[model samples]
Target: MTSSRLDGTSALVTGGGSGIGLACARRLAADGADVMICGRTAERLQAAAKELGCRYVVADVVDEDQVAAAVRATAATSPLRAVIHCAGGTTSVGPIPQLDTAAWRDTLELNATGTMLVLKHSARLMARTGGGAFVAISSIASSNTHRWFGAYGVSKAAVDHLVQLGADELGGAGIRVNGIRPGLVRTELVAGITDPGPVLDDYLACMPLDRVGEPEDIAEAARFLAGPESSWITGQVVNVDGGHHLRRGPDFRAVFEPMFGAEALGGVIPEE
Candidate 1:
């Protein structure tokens, strides 16, 4: 029943097995784009692709060889109209003094390097055929940060810059590169950060919307960027953080205050 804005377009989404990536894949498909999804897990990728009426590929973004292959695979059978790079994660969390070098490296590899790989192959393919749209998933963490978010924030910062660089180089080829920086969205990835102490509540207090973002929220933005609606936009990092970045973030403890009750604020941690 939904009208499609991309009836003849095609898109490839990395990390499309779940979370935001899956959401983007579904949205693109709904918009009538021929979608191709890539993930490290074959089963998950296949399932997601089937559910979305899209194609599937198994590849790790951090692997250069695999990245090239993924691009070729997706391009071979589709018109290659757009690309959504969403394969990234935080490898570690903690103060700098306690940060693990390997973990930090892994974070950069997966986020920054991986983004470059996807864009690289996509750009090459798009260049040959004139041009296409490329959108990357960044994070609000890139601008606002805490002690434990160093690696994650830095990696996203790189992604933001990468978008600008892509715009500079690829614009001539008719390609538009942009990014979407989202705040705390409920996803399986967030569930693993138990020590963060209710990440959603921490973000909700200061966010103007007083609510956590949904993957669909980001999907809507990506849809715009991919379609002709945003044809004139490029090299921009759009904040989809429910205005969380507009206001000053609460103190670390204040951020988590919602997790505790009135009694806890008054005097006690409260017994479970």
Candidate 2:
């Protein structure tokens, strides 16, 4: 179905420089919202902004001062109607013993703390006008387990709760808060893996839909959460995982066994 539901509305998307964020920004713009894309990288943000015909802001969500500034800047230019928290990254991967403290902390700050900042500032502004929508991009990892994904998963679990807290508090004020938890998606980050081919094949095998996710899949969900169609849907965590959550994940053991030799079978506790 087609929608001009967001006509005259304005949206600010963090991490909108590429990937799912960019897809959501463009979709919002097409649906009639005046969109704003923000990211730490100026060049990438500008390119994305230009493509979507939306404004761009350079702000690292992990930096509170930068986040506040970005919020103020967005407020100065438009009547903000929605905020999509998509700025995040997993800088490291390993079991706790092998994990770097700094990387773990950064992951928490970027995914959980950053989302809190965006929600806090945006809710304050949107509430002043008596309402808006806030949609966070969480991950299936929040409810799933994986090797070397502990820090990232924990942070996202925090985000899921945080989003609900925002929703519970703001729903009375007419501001709705929700989030989308996506499974394995095809993006630059996923492509960065050394040998994603076999791993992805295994992932696809477990999905009921038998396919990997795309940025647009998540983007469409974001648009729905942002628009009036979901007016009564607050404090919800929608999974756009192409049915991956319904089945067991790939056999990481078989995928990584050869690479790690006997160690993959000997010492490590196999993940589900």
Clashes of 1: 0
lDDT score, residue 102, model 2?
A: 91
Query: What TM-score does structure 1 among the candidates reach?
Result: 0.88
Model 1 RMSD vs true structure: 6.2
Q: List TM-scores for all candidates, in order.
A: 0.88, 0.91
lDDT per residue (tens digit) for residues 132-189 in model 1 = 9999999988877653454988999999999999999899999999999988776888
Q: How well does candidate 2 match the true structure, expressed as C-alpha RMSD?
A: 3.4
Clashing residue pairs in candidate 2 are none
Scored against the true structure, residue 55 in model 1 reaches a CA lDDT of 90
Clashes of each: 0, 0
- Look at candidate 1 and give me any clashing residue pairs: none
